[model samples]
Target chain A: MNDERLERYARQLLVPGFGEAAQERLGRARVRVVGADAVASAGLVYLVQAGVGRLWIEDAEDVSPSDASGWLFAPSAVGSPRVEAARAVLAPLSRFVSIEPYPKGGVPTATLVFASSGPQALASAEAARRAGIPHVVVEPDAEGGALVVVPPGAPCYACARSTAGAGRPAQPGIAALSALGAAELVLMIANPESTPGRRIDLVRGVATARPTSRLPGCACGGPGAGAT
Target chain B: MSASAPPRVDVRAYACPMTYVKAKIALERLAAGERLEVWLAAGEPVENLPRSAAEDGHRVLAVEPLAGAPGAFRVVLEKGAGAAPEWP
Candidate 1:
């Protein structure tokens, strides 16, 4: 990251472990965000702020009144397609970082894909699984924001869905969680030294959440790579 | 069912994936064991209708030619017993 880029992301880069190098890593990375709703909006803003090099957003949805409740979008954006609205928000953040917005929903070429909890988020998760792309699905909690990380190919979003007995396809209160979850996922993908099958979580100021333990024979490369 | 029940979907103007995407949404709203009847134009759905329905764990009860419409077909599908889909 150059001096100009560092100044651009000064707030985030000022954090303890995150600095110019991390911002540089983010700039060199390609990330795919499925769905540009409230949660995705929040998560994407953070990623853009961090200067992720290439952002591929897949959503065929139009901006509705509900999206105005989130940050990064204004009331005037109502009825505009989310891709168009988001491009305007992201353009000012980083000129070096390329933004590729897909009007139709499908997998784009990316190193990491993030799906926030919702119907479309789940659909994005399913598509990523089917395409063999690494992904993370996030859901946030009500109090001070708790994050549940569904890392790619491990205890996947599908596995979490089944385990949680998620009766509704997309559960309620999923938007905030999904966005925060995706932000964390971008962080993980941006860090090159991160080992495979790593699971970590953060509860605002509480503590850093780590996976209970690596799942033995987990296809996330903790053990078995072919276990699905 | 009524003697003159409305068709569940009219897909004359849609293309691939849009057709399938619309069909999937309709299927999601249906109760288990119920059927959705779809009418499509003379293209992809002739084959894609059955393929997409099967992929969703639904049963394609019938796929027959529509009278007076060249290359068009009517597709009827019964929703399968499974967890509700995440997407429509």
Candidate 2:
């Protein structure tokens, strides 16, 4: 690594187990971020700041007025495509990371899904699982949010997600939860063997994590689990 | 006693965290039982680097002032056999 990069990632390098090798892995990662609105802004920032090399933002919707409440989108960007607006804001955060609109057929080494709807989250997480890639899913509620981390060969997100929480209006706490989701993905990418599949629920201010278990008869436990 | 020149890093220009960061990266490049020499400015850098390195499981072999460089010091650290700390 060059001197500038050494300086740029100095703090992360100080983290135990997160030295030059982990930083290099992050620099080589191609991450797909499934949403670009308020809920995903913090995660996108965290990923870029942590030096994820390439980011493909997959959001077809246009930025809405509510998106202005998030840190990444400007009021003027309300009418533009969400991905484009996100790329604009995220590009300036780090020169090491390449932010772009998710292209058709682009393959990501990892994924972070912040889908607005349950169906969207389910589809994206399932696709990532089938591809055998590590992924994190953010399910934000008014109280806080939950994150499902699925490393390759671990339980799928569907099996890990909580069925009790109903989707509610986006609150400020969602940003913290989203950032936590990014941290989970970072750990999964940096130390795959040490990071197991789990679910982390952030309620109010407390965060609780539990190992994810395969629900009975869930396809994730079958012989074809993680099969592409 | 047998002796070998250890890998050296000069982190005098960097501040807290960066000083240890540079030293840690240099240490990571070495194998277990290998030694790293870090040259750092006095005060917090000198005071904190050795402790931080030790906390990360590396052994602090020696910490002393560099010859003719007043207020500057060198730290020798021997890499340990323990695995790097795991992430949550």
Candidate 3:
């Protein structure tokens, strides 16, 4: 990486495990964020700041002042498309990354997909699943946030959504929850550890956590389950 | 009514996606940085629509349900200080 690039990401690169190699992995990776609203505001920003090589943003809405009330976006960016505005924010921060602004509906090829756009993005996420791509779904609540990651060969986001009854579209909420959820998903994706085919539920505020396995014929059908 | 203020549009009767759509139409026709106050009935749009407006770069002043009209909200969406984009 060039001096400028390293300097731009100096803070994150300072992390012990996120040296040059990890940064390269981040740069070489492709990420698609389905919704660009308050819930996803920080997650998208974090990924961009982390130097994810190419970022694809899909949201079919315009920015509003209230949307900027959250920390994720600035008031100056109100009325801009989420992708365009997010790109503008991340551009000067990292030249190594490319941000593609796509209207809602089109699903680009991505190694990982983050669903924060409610249900609309989930349909497109299904397409990614059929293509066998790893995906993570984030739902941030006012109290905290919920993150569901579909590791490679793990149950897809579609199934997870269905299982959680969040398979359909819904409204948006605070940026904190969404950003935290996005961070959790990204960490799981970057490190396999012991979370595969394992479903985890947590209450960030209460510090309560649970891990469970899917039952047979639960519709996920395991990693071999057919992509819908 | 303040002589300086224009009439507002009510979008509370609408739902998600459409809430964003109607707000977009209003914001587009409005002058730069003009305010378009929308009233949205309670539902998914409450969550999705404001976020949509913010995502597209509009300004959302406030979002609170109407009194005794649970789920309905009076939202004030202000056009940005710049020109609005062409509607999709």
> Chain B alone: TM-score in each candidate?
0.82, 0.90, 0.77
C-alpha DockQ of every model: 0.01, 0.52, 0.01
| Model 3 C-alpha lDDT per residue in residues A81-135, reported as the tens digit of each score | 8678777776776667788875456444343344544565567556665655556
Is candidate 1 or 2 superior in DockQ? 2
What does candidate 1's lDDT look like per residue over A119-163, in tens digits? 655676666655555566544333223344443444545444322
The order of the candidates by lDDT, greatest first, is 2, 3, 1
Write down the TM-score for model 1. 0.53
Give the DockQ-based CAPRI class for model 3: incorrect
Predicted chain A of model 3: TM-score relative to the true chain A?
Answer: 0.73
In candidate 2, what fraction of native interface contacts survive? 0.58
Worst 10 residues of 1 chain B by lDDT: B79-88
TM-score of chain A of each: 0.68, 0.96, 0.73
Error of 3 at B66 (Å): 73
TM-score per candidate, chains pooled: 0.53, 0.94, 0.56
How many collisions per candidate? Answer: 3, 0, 28
Error of 3 at A172 (Å): 13
